[model samples]
Target: MRLNQPRIKPLSPEGLTPEQAEILAPLGGGGVIPAGPVLNIFRTMAHAPKALKAFLTWGNYILSRKNDLPPREREIVILRTGFLCKSGYEWTQHVEIGLRCGLTQDEIVMLKTGPDAGWSPADAALIRAADELNADYFISDATWAALLTYFSEKQAMDVVFTAGQYTQVSMMLNSFGVQLDSGQTLDPDLRKA
Candidate 1:
């Protein structure tokens, strides 16, 4: 773990209330997502007791399933959102997953900047939508309409949810200085301002 950073405090099942316990139990299961800062962050939400648990639980669902959108599209949305936030932790983690969902190294590289490096119309629209949402908490009607052709009603909602989740994640990672994986680096543009 990096010094002076938001390190993953170890996960222990003890001292948890039934409510928080039910919520946290799955996080400890490696099959779910492996024990890491991401899950640890969610676990810390338990600090707020029952009140914050609702938000935390809903967040886990939306972020993990995102069933409305296809994996490829959702991954694109997430990576672009992460890039817009200049979130090293988010970028490092998602870049690999994005590739698994068929995002090429070039596509992931293009995500670092404002959707201007010659992305396809749909891809460009996705990036622009995230930028718009980040700046305004809402996407432009034009971008929304453009995405409707490719994304379903549920997917449309998922796109926004996924974007919003990563935004929250990026803000936490950047402000908290969650270290990028040791010895691994992302694209230069992704690390660029």
Candidate 2:
């Protein structure tokens, strides 16, 4: 959504090189070669199979159960980071992911409003941590202390990891002009960006 057209066009099925196809194999297997519509992010990332593989490996950790933060809390940090980065594509994609992870639509909307939008103290700490990470590249001691009150040290570390990962994702999506996938509608707040 950052640009009218993608800076690097996502490869079509016919255009995929063998390496790209292998990277995208999980999406479609056997002889299908990307069976369904690939999300713009993945398809675009496929352009660099090695990098895409690396991205997915680290990304898997952040999204996997291995992460100390629960799924809902992870989504909160991701959504907050996407919003703070003004990444419309990220916001659109993760809005669904956030909802599936137990974040209400109202909470997603509230993320755009700021960190103190009536979230519980623990959730507020997570949001503030994302905000601080986005704005200052570091979370304050007070915010860290707030987070420790409700989450383990490892969970707190996951908070930074999740926020940092999504921050990088948002930057890539915005800079690359990775648009929303099919059936996605842009949030009005990000229409200008």
Candidate 3:
């Protein structure tokens, strides 16, 4: 939605090179890949197979239990970062993931207003961390302290890395013009932003 057209078009699975096909093979029908359009982000990233492969490693860790943050908490940071970055693609994709992670529709909407949107103290801390990381590239002492009260060192580290990772992802999706997958809807706030 940020751009009318994609700068880098998505690659179709049928058109993949042998090496790219091998890289994507594990992501097919019953592999670790999520059930949706594989050509969305993956196709675009396939232009650089090594980068995409490395990205998947870190991405899997972040979404896996190794990150320490609960799914809901992780979604809070992701949605907030996506919103702050004004990334329609990331925002649209994460809205569904967030809901599955236990965030309510209202909570999802409230993310656009940021940490001051009447979230619990802990949730607000997570959002504030995203905002700070986006705007300042560093978390403030107060935000860091608040986060310390609720998250372990690993969770705190995951919070920073997750925000940074998605921030990078937003830049990629926006710059490359990654569109929403099938059945995904763009948030009104994303459209306006």
lDDT of each: 0.69, 0.86, 0.87
How well is each residue in 74-110 modelled by candidate 3, as lDDT tens digits? 9999989998999999888788789988999999989
TM-score of each: 0.72, 0.94, 0.94
Off by over 4 Å in 2: 28-36
lDDT of 1: 0.69
Query: lDDT, candidate 3, residue 42?
Result: 79
Give me the runs in candidate 3 sitting further than 4 Å from their true place: 29-33
lDDT against true structure, model 2? 0.86
Which residue pairs show backbone clashes in model 1? none
lDDT leaderboard ranking: 3, 2, 1
Candidate 3 collision pairs: none
- TM-score: model 1 vs. ground truth: 0.72
